[model samples]
Target: MKDTHKHQGLRNQLVKIISEKGITDKNVLNAIAAVPRHLFMDSGFVDFAYQDKAFPIAADQTISQPYTVAFQTQLLAIKPNQKILEIGTGSGYQTAVLIEIGAKVYTIERQLELFKKTKFFLPKLHYKPKKMVFGDGYKGLPEEAPFDGIIVTAGAPIVPNALLAQLKIGGKLVIPIGDEVQIMTLFVRNSEKDFEKHELGEFRFVPMLKEKN
Candidate 1:
């Protein structure tokens, strides 16, 4: 749990790398600088944490690659205090990044082991989400309807209509859609019935699975 000076230096290096790769949002980069990326993984692999690559975590999940997180977040154009629903809460790393940039996050994790681990882990780092739920990601949190933005960390075979329905009109849904290799897709709700769609590019992610616990 110790975030040493070495760790901070590594994080700074990571920020520079992602910025060069085209993450222009200052807030996003600042959030990247603020979160201790190394602390998100098992200590043995901490050396690779600042390399902008995805690494394995509990429950057979991989912490998303840094560029992928930054890309999806930059697309959302997060504003302070905006409500954001995150479909997967793998390492709680991305949630921490969102919190750093000032979005109020409500994250759901389907894997019980990772969910439990992250539930206790995030707050230890002092990154608290608005809500952390153990449930199916496909079924967005309807009770907390009308979020300003929604991000799905795992690759969905198809966009979950429930997620789109949960967005406020003018809200954005950033998800990766496909099988094997997912295309980063954005859906912006224009009106109650009109939503705009865009496919940015392809990235690989663990599959979004059904509820098991």
Candidate 2:
């Protein structure tokens, strides 16, 4: 059974944090609240699951902060059953939240160890994504083109053209764009080859690098 109290505590903390930070999307909140974050982190760090902080996992990747997760999801403006693409799977925490929002998710993870670990934990957490690919995130999943929404967990110096090409017209993409410190970016496909870009705010995320393992 879902641990309602523990989950509720996390929800309450998220609401307080987002409200103070000016996040207004209730759907995003609901999704964040629904996913149990402790399941996504190391057992030693499970106690800090609800805190508004990023925590490290394997492969030098860290799960994004609660506010960032909620903020990015809000930017996507997800619709029920929308097909979504996630560039970095990491700990699969964001994917879990995306699934809670009813998105059919296709996530690509470059790190083999992280991918293998998550492949085990994801099913354990009941977050069986539509598809999981182990490949270079820069080259996205070409076979699964035309997504309704796309999210990149890692920060990149410039938005990859390939990822931009995968979005269907009217699709939304929320990514962090920069080399060092990134600004959260929202891209909406305006036409066949045009996009409307919105700079959300400054945020810090691990650099999006090709996985060595």
Candidate 3:
């Protein structure tokens, strides 16, 4: 639907809440404010769009909480026009944020329903990723390797070695690692085989599946 004044106001309030929660990256916050989160969600959940909570979307997946999106994006330290590989396109809300920040995104979605739906839906919102693939994210986009950043939207049991290999030297990978509760993890590629890792705390995300549904 329409992004009304009320929607914008709610977004402003949401931005403030995330900011207070320590999302200091202005670019990330601006992207969050700019996206019409309500439209990305199903109409039934529109009223709670800016509440910083996750809601069920199609394909048995949940659109991530707004705070989680901001937190992961902030960790990426995005720069305009950088190449970003996003695992799990989900509801495409996170894809919209990456596009808003001027990254060239190549996003992968494993669920066939979500892959087709989000592939068609995103362009309607004027958020166009460089490439949208229906494939296993664990494999990553090998042909399009050397990304400036890679974001895994779901919780992984272990970091995918393929993803690490695809990152450009000095690029960053933001992902959550665990099953029941994930620890927000960041990896900075220092060289071909070396990485600097950091654990940013706990979050809950849908499990990252290997095969397409």
- Which candidate wins on TM-score? 3
**Backbone collision tally, model 3:** 0
Pairs clashing within candidate 2: none
Pairs clashing in candidate 3?
Answer: none
Candidate 2 residue runs with Cα over 4 Å from true position: 1-4, 211-213
Model 2 scores worst on lDDT over the 10 consecutive residues at 1-10
Quick one: ranking by lDDT, best first? 3, 1, 2
Instruction: Pick the winner on TM-score between candidates 1 and 2.
Output: 1
Model 2 TM-score, all chains together: 0.95
lDDT-wise, the better of 1 and 3 is 3
Which sections of candidate 3 miss by over 4 Å?
none
Best candidate according to lDDT: 3
The residue-by-residue lDDT of candidate 3 on 91-127, one tens digit each, is 9999999999999999999999999999999999999
RMSD of 2: 1.6
Give the Å error, residue 51, model 3.
0.4
lDDT of 2 by residue, 1-213 (tens): 356686787768877787689778877887777788877888889878888899999988899998999889988988889999999999999999899888999999999999899988898878899999998898888898999999999999989889999999999888899987899999999999889999988999999987565
- Reference-based lDDT, each prediction: 0.93, 0.89, 0.96
What is candidate 1's local distance difference test score?
0.93
